[model samples]
Target: MVTGALAAAGFAAGALLPPRPAFASEQLTIISWGGGYQDVQLRKSFFEPFTKATGIKITEDQWNGEVSKVRAMVQTNTVNWDVLDVGVGIGELCSHGLVETLNWNRLGLDRTKFLGDDKTLDCGVPHHASSTVIAYDRTKLKNGPKTIADFFDLQKFPGKRAMQKGPTSNLEWALVADGVLIKDVYKVLATPAGVDRAFKKLDTIKKDVIWWTAGTQPAQLLGNGQVVMSTAWSGSINNAVKESGLPLEIMWDAQMLSLDFWVIPKGARHLDEAYKFLAFGGSPKPQADMTRYGNNGPANKDAMALVDPTIGPNLTTSPAHMANSLEFDYSFWGDKRDELNQRFTAWVVQQ
Candidate 1:
């Protein structure tokens, strides 16, 4: 009955292509950022059930969040992926016709229920939301810092700190800590003086910060007592704590919340099945089930009531934690990604 309902919601099976196509009629291919976060979560919470319900064999693969590969596969007439897990570039790719456009009406997806408005999403189906927040070891700092300013203030909360090497969230956090309002972070970051101010604020703790490029590093550092607090991915910290019982707590103040969406590459092998997978993956129950094992906040607003309350408070989209967070500006990153990436890299090496 549920599968029948999803079919009505646009999950109708596609016409079986030739016997020797890129994927057989029974096989569906999916690409995502593998490892525990994407691999384990999707396999258990999404793929296994999807396969059970539809009897389609699913083959999962991983990528390093490189849209270039997706573009190449599509342009070369060798597109194999049915669905893609993407962070940024959804809009640009959609405009360039590199990814398929979404039909909310057909998918039975409620636009009003997703976290951000439709304009912010660029036609991708968001599975869950995660944020880069301050994660502290409660055992070490009983009275941990509450705001971005506290995270920056060396004297008030003195301890080793870890920050992602990139400047996306760091730049915004720096300005907010230096007295810029959370709402004005991007506005100030737009100005030359504001850029200087953010860099200078970062310089204050340059010596104190342990730069990390991988998502797992911050959680590991916190558990190993290498840093008292770290700017960590909310999901990664939650998983670490659940697996090992780490005394970690996340501070959601000024958090830069980001949504990971499922997109279909242009001319994907299985368009109907891809759409079906995305819609199924984001429905209330599946979204809620993901939170039971990991800290990812469900994209469906109606799904919150289904999540265990014990785990709800730790999710990035949880009401208690989400009120103080900011939706990351996807447009800003789309426009300035390269320029800022270069500047940030140079600044990091020079420091």
Candidate 2:
């Protein structure tokens, strides 16, 4: 239900999609980060068009991004979701054989140059891309933050701040603000002292931080003047600005780019139909549609050509912004999530 409320955004499909079919197939319940991000964005860009094209009635459900919930369904052989649009844990689940094996060729995808090295795992089709970046009210901070270090420089950029209530991107930003190179974030985080150092940096502004859990909260917090700046998902803040006329601007410096994937759980009831949907969604046109309608970048690099040039400036992978960005180290999180989360949890409760 958290995913449901967190995603308050918009949706629309592309005119580029081919004509829809007169008929539809059996229904499938796809799980994803819900609310408008799923209900509006994917439904318009991919699902509705997919149903029209192949006659597959796609129903969507929200999941809390917990691997254990997915594991429970897999182990009990009660997998209801046909396709899962999941985040960072795909690598860990794939390693444990919890997700179905992906067939790159069958999915109508090549080695995706979209993600630099095509971070395509064997168990998932990489879909849309997003990033954790600093967003500030241009009206509030006339000359705003342009880098992660600016986020920590309270003296120069003084304002109450809103940050996600988790250590994932926060730790990375902490280190970067402490003068760690973008490329060296995860490497430094892998060590005990590295983590301590990140937390120590965070302590500098701990009292000033307004912790947010839902994705929508950061945007809402900023729009309502609860905080002048926040680290927010690209899609969430952009959608809020477009919808509510919030005078927000995203600072792309050292943005951590990440991609979500569509995966079939091992015991999916609509196995074959699900695979068809997976392939359909990954096609270039729909990926472009998603970018056009939402804040995410396309997982397929070729999609850039199809998307209107107007939105290019806001994209995470745009030529202008990509230079200063760093791709998130999913493997680092996959290997160290438990250990790191424990420390992060204890730190949060202390003050």
lDDT (0 to 1) per candidate:
0.81, 0.81
Q: How many angstroms is residue 325 displaced in model 1 relative to the true structure, after the best TM-score fit?
A: 0.2
Q: What is the lDDT of candidate 1?
A: 0.81
- Pick out the ten consecutive residues of candidate 2 with the lowest summed lDDT: 6-15
Q: Which digits, one per residue and each the tens of the lDDT, describe model 2 over residues 187-235?
A: 8989989999999999999888999998889888988898889999887
Over 112-222, each residue of candidate 1 has an lDDT whose tens digit, in order, gives 788754655556888888888999999989999989899999999887899999888999999989999878888998887998899999999988999998888998998
Off by over 4 Å in 2: 1-27, 116-120
**What value does the lDDT take at residue 259 in candidate 1?**
86
